[model samples]
Every structure is written in C-alpha cells, then in structure tokens.
Target: MELEKKKIVEHNDLIMSSAKMDTVPLKFFELAVSEIDTFNPPKDNTIYLSKRDMFKFLNAKDNDNDKYHRFKQAISKMQKQAFFEIREEKGKGFVFRNIVPIPYVEWKSYSDEVKIRFDVEIMPYLTELKTNFTQFALTDIQGLNSKHSIIIYKWLNMNYNQFEYYKKNGNRDGQQLYNLCNPIIEVDELRWLTNTQKEYVGRFTNFEIYVIKKPIKEINKYTRFNVSYDKIREGRKITKIQFHISLKGEKTIENSSSKPKKVVTLADAQQSPYSQLLIGAFLLQISDVQDEKLMLSLAAKIYPKYDEFVEKYSLDILKKHLEYVKAHSTNIKDLVTYLDNALENYQKRLVGQEKDNKESKPKNRKKGVIQKEKIPDYISNPGKNKLTQKGIEDSKAADELLAKINGDLK
Candidate 1:
C-alpha cells in the first residue's frame, strides 16, 4: 500500500497546476501512476493495480470493513467531482482544460487486482515529456499529512530543480537566476497555485495563517525544502508575496532520476557567457588565463565546484565579493579553496548588506512585511514565457537527475 520509494515524474506544467484532493485519493492516484510504463504505455488505455495493495496503501484494516464502502464513495466523487483543472496562457488568451484522470476503475470482489484506464486527454502530460519535468519519490510525500504539503512540495521541487539546472549549466545570471530560488507571486497567483481562490479571499490574516503559513510550515517539517513567505507591499497595501526557498541542510537533494549526473566541464562552460564573464573577472583579480599550464591547473581545481559558485552568486555579486577577497588576502595557494571560503563568508553578509536600504517598508498578511522591490516577471507568471534553445536549458541540464527511483529510464 505504501509503495517503497515509488517515484513519479510529472511535467512542470501539471506540477504547477492545481490539484485539489484529499490525502487518500491523492495517494491512490499516485500509486496507480507509479505503475505506468510511461515509455511503453498500455495500448488499450488500461492498467491493472493490486486491490489488496491499494487497500493497504489506503490503510484499510482487516476489521474495518467500512473503508471498502468508503472507497466506492470516493471513486464516485472522483468520477463526478475530482478532476485536474489546468489553465495555461495560450497565445494572447489562456486555455482551461478539465480532465477527469481516471474514469474507469473496476474490480470484482473475488479479484485481488483492480483495472483502470487513464483518460487519453491526460496521457501526454503524464508521459513523454518534451522539455520541462520534475521527478520525485512518492516516499518524499508519504509522511505528509495535508494536500497543501503534497502540492507545494512538487512546486518547490520544480523551482529548485530549475534553480540547480541553471546553476550547473552556467547560463542564468543577474535577476533571472536569483528569482529561481526566491520567487515573488501575486496574492491571486498564490491562491491559484494552491487552488484556494475561494477560501481566504478578503480575510488577509486568515489567508496568511491557513493558506500561506500552515502549508509552508508543513512542507518545511516534512519535505527537503525549507521555505518561508513574506507579504510584499506597494506603498501602503500589500499586493504581492515572496517565497524564499532553499534546501534544509546542505544543497538540495538531486532528483530521483536514474541517469548519471551531467557534469559541466570548464571546457563546456567556456562557451557560456555567464561562465566566460565569471572566469574572466576572477582571472583578472587572481591569475592570468594566458598561461596555458597554470590555467589548466587552475581549471582542474575549480571545475569540480564551478557549478556551486555559479549557482550561489550572480556575476555582479561575485565581482563585489572578488574585490573584497583580493583586498584582504594575499599569496593564496589554493584558488578554489580561497574562493569558496570567500563565497560562504560573502553570502553570510548578504542579509546585512540589505540593511543599507533600511527605509522600513510594508505587509498586513504576515508579521514581517517587506518593502516592494522590483519584481521579476518570471516568478509572477511562470511557464508563460517561451525560451529559445540556448535560454536556460534546464531539461537538458538535469537529464541525469531525472531518473526514476525504480530505475526506470524516463
């Protein structure tokens, strides 16, 4: 019933879309999806599942026979009420698709297994990913007690995966890169993401408490993401929300993909503009790149952690930190060690650096309201902008980390 590390890979669009369901049905859907051979899906649009395992997954007890009846009720509701409400911007206007995912679920009382068919409308989103997708272990949400936890976890996973992909690929820089980790959203957009457009409409306090804080708290406790949100204000009124997301302990865990991690070589990064500027700037301060032997030696030292450096610091930030590093230290033996140490030290002071702008700004929703800084359009309306082939190839960057837990090559 509680599948062992069963991994689910979903397109980024579906992950970001709204799915409002109770914990039991969500688990049931995931379990069934975990069974699909996505590459070679069922020809007849059907899949068979273990009824006993499904019941066990539902935590139905041998003595508690009422759950079977309850299961029927849930299935009936699923047919009539449970559906994925997907809305995406289509050209100048937006398109909405309501998909009843599993309409055909059948089982005989004598049979140990259940047979079900996925709606053809929902197949492409679930299988055969084109560019963007997210892969995570079902066990990651196994302990989650709420639907919000499940939903937000996937959303965070999608963003974090993109963040890492950019960090590793060395294409993203400036505001474009930083917003991946800390995204700003309109209150309405946040409501859409959580499927709570109706719940806390005018009640700002209640909205902050129930919709924003509680889900984030649950996610922080159960998931790998340590996320916190703050209300942002324009003049006196709070209109937007900013979520600061980072890994709980160390760097975020890699996705549950079976492919080997794709390493971005110094050679590979030479073609990237972000890396070119970074390498050029750092070299101007520490060493000259003209010397081939020394450059090769230095590349060997830094290539291992070049991604880490790129991920954390934009060129502007890195340049400032480099100036500080040069003024304080002299005769550095290990360039990688010195730079990394400086990065950590520099990162620590970044919060304090913001204090320089202490004009005391605004949020009625949360206790800590931040002043309205410039908002990146990407965070406000994600998946709305189409990128060229060279623009932040996250799907290409994270090819290896997209493996399934069961070692299915997605």
Candidate 2:
C-alpha cells in the first residue's frame, strides 16, 4: 500500500527549537502537524486529525492488539507537558522556558477524528513562511523510533535544506557547499537538541552512546542523510562536535566519484527475495534512499549465505521467526540483536525438525524413495533440504512450486 507523503513545514528557527518530549508524544505531535495546511495556516490553532491515518502510517496492525491505548497516553501527555526550552529568540532581550507547543486536545471514544490545538505562541513559526522554513516528507521519520533521532534529523534537515536552496539558486561552489555542515555544537547544545541536559549530566560516555551514537546510527540507516562527525577536544575531554552530512547512496566528500545507489520503494520489495524477507520480517522499511543497505544490514548477515542462502533457506522459516519477533518486540530492546538470535533459533529448529522427520519416516516405500541423484531436482527449491525422501515420493505440485521459487532466486 502507498503511504501518503505527509510534508511538514516548520520555520528554520522552529527546526532549531528543542523541547523535552517523549517519543510517542513527539510522534503524535508531528502526525497532527501534518494535518495542518501550512501555506494557508489556520486562523485558529485547531487541527482535526484521523487516528486511522496515524496508525496506518506506523503500520500498527495487530494480531488483535494494543497501540491505541498508548496513543491515548501520548495525547494525554502532550496536553500536560510543557517544553523545557526553546532556542529560537525573538530579539535576544530574554529567553523563554516551560513553553507548551500543543496545549489542548479534545476527543471522543466514538469518533476517529481528534481535535488538537497548537499553542498560540507557536502559530507564527508554523504559518505563512515565505523564507527560512524547512520542508520534508513525514515518511523520512516514519520509521524512526527514537525521539533524539527525530530532533537530530530536524537539525540536519535545516542545514541540508539550506544547502539545497543555495545550489538551486546557482551558488554551487566549494564554499557554498560548506553550508551543509552546521558549526560545532557544544555538548550542552547537543543535550538541548535532545532535551536531556539534566538527565545525561556528568555521564559523558553514557550520553555519547545513547544520545549521540545510537541516534546517529538510526538517522543514517533510516533517513536520506548519511551523517558523520568530528569531535573537538579540550585536552582529553570531548568539548564539541561538528557534523558532516551527505545524501545517502550519493556522492560525498570521501567518495565524490561514487555513483548513487538505486533507492527501492516498498513496491519494489515485491521483486527481490532478500527485500521480501527483510520487509516481510519487519527488519526494515524503505521509504527513502535506495539501495539494499538498510535491508541487508543486520538481517542480511544471518539472512544469507548469499545465493547459497536462497537454496538453503525459505521465506517460511524467516516469517515464522518474524512473527515471533513481532509478538515479543516490546520486550526485545535491540531488535537487530533479538532478530539475529531468533533467526539462529529458527535455523536450529528447522535442522532438528528435518532430522526428526527423516528418522520418523519409513525407509523402504512400496512406491519407493526418490534416487539420490533425483533428490536435487525434487528438492531444488528454497528450503532445499526440507523435503524428506518419503515426502518427495508423495509431493509433486509442492515440489514444483518450491522449484520455481528457488529458480527465481537465480
């Protein structure tokens, strides 16, 4: 299914603005923002949004289950919590703190429509932006699970959008291209970006891992940008960071001669077997940046032994494990790690199941077991070794279907 391309427009200053928001509320806020008509901004702060639309964007289908309650909690939190800090300044006379971006909401259990209001203070930032605004597809962040990743992505978007604007206005030069990287952001600024100045205080290592490294990994892996950074140090202590950014699968400072990779959309996933497993297993979803980079990252390592993988493993084995992963995903903190373990366990089960099936079979059949040489043809499909000798004698259409899948992989 094609997801609606929800474009969000925010003033560059608003993009620079940082706030303390949990991931769910932030997601809810953005989804609501997408509903507003930014060009002709609403006279009133109210926006009517659909619960079905937001749920569909996130692929929240259940095996008969529970995301709506969390959605309710997020809406509740959005109304109660105030932003701790906002970096955007009007005239630099004073700074404001404890601001609420979306201060009120009203909804009914019977209706799918949600009525939410943006704080009147934020109206100027959202409306009638002829200049100094950032626009991007909401899908760029649809899969991002981290609140920090969302904030950092906005930071990257601000500079990158500026770079694109300059290039479009016929200012493409080495110096002009330099606009892609924002100036060195201090550690405090990083915390401001994540709204975690109080929490990660004094624990630089933990902050660096959770607040910096991990979010960057998600941003680079999932978004259109490939971001890198260089740290400025105060003797032994890391003091500041300057980011380097480029389009994913595109030419970069390091590889200017390299060609970009073809970005595969969800529609394209239907064709490639590797993509099918990756998408089907919910390991990755492709909305931006082509290539198989994200698709093949964690799952690919175990997903394949390459072409030999196609012959050895089938989609059924992977799907079984993926379903298991989905069931317990809340408990699985690191999905890549958990998915790797799940795949490994499934492989062992398949091996053991085939062994037991082999032993449980009657060796001498009246119709006879397929000859050793014919084994390859009968079982030439994906999950190649799965067909037992006796089953091979009984199987015809199933054998052909499996053979077709194996052949398609070639």
For all predictions, the C-alpha RMSD in Å is 23.0, 23.6
Regions more than 4 Å wrong, model 1: 59-64, 251-410
lDDT of 1 by residue, 1-410 (tens): 34775678888778877776666666677777877766877777788888777766666787887988977876777777777778777899979888888888998989888888888987887787768888877667766666767777787788778888988997876455557766667877777877788887775898888777887888888677788776775334567776778887764222443222233333333333433434433333222333334444445555445456546545544544544455466887866677667666655565554453354433233433222332232112335555445333533432322222113211
Residue-level lDDT tens digits of model 2 in 306-344: 334336765444444454555456755554576667656
Question: Ten residues in a row with the worst lDDT in model 2?
Answer: 368-377
List the candidate 2 regions with Cα displacement exceeding 4 Å: 1-3, 90-94, 171-173, 254-410
Q: Estimate each model's TM-score.
A: 0.57, 0.58
The CA lDDT of each predicted structure is 0.64, 0.65
TM-score of 1: 0.57
Ten residues in sequence with the least summed lDDT for candidate 1:
401-410
Cα lDDT for residue 183, model 1? 69
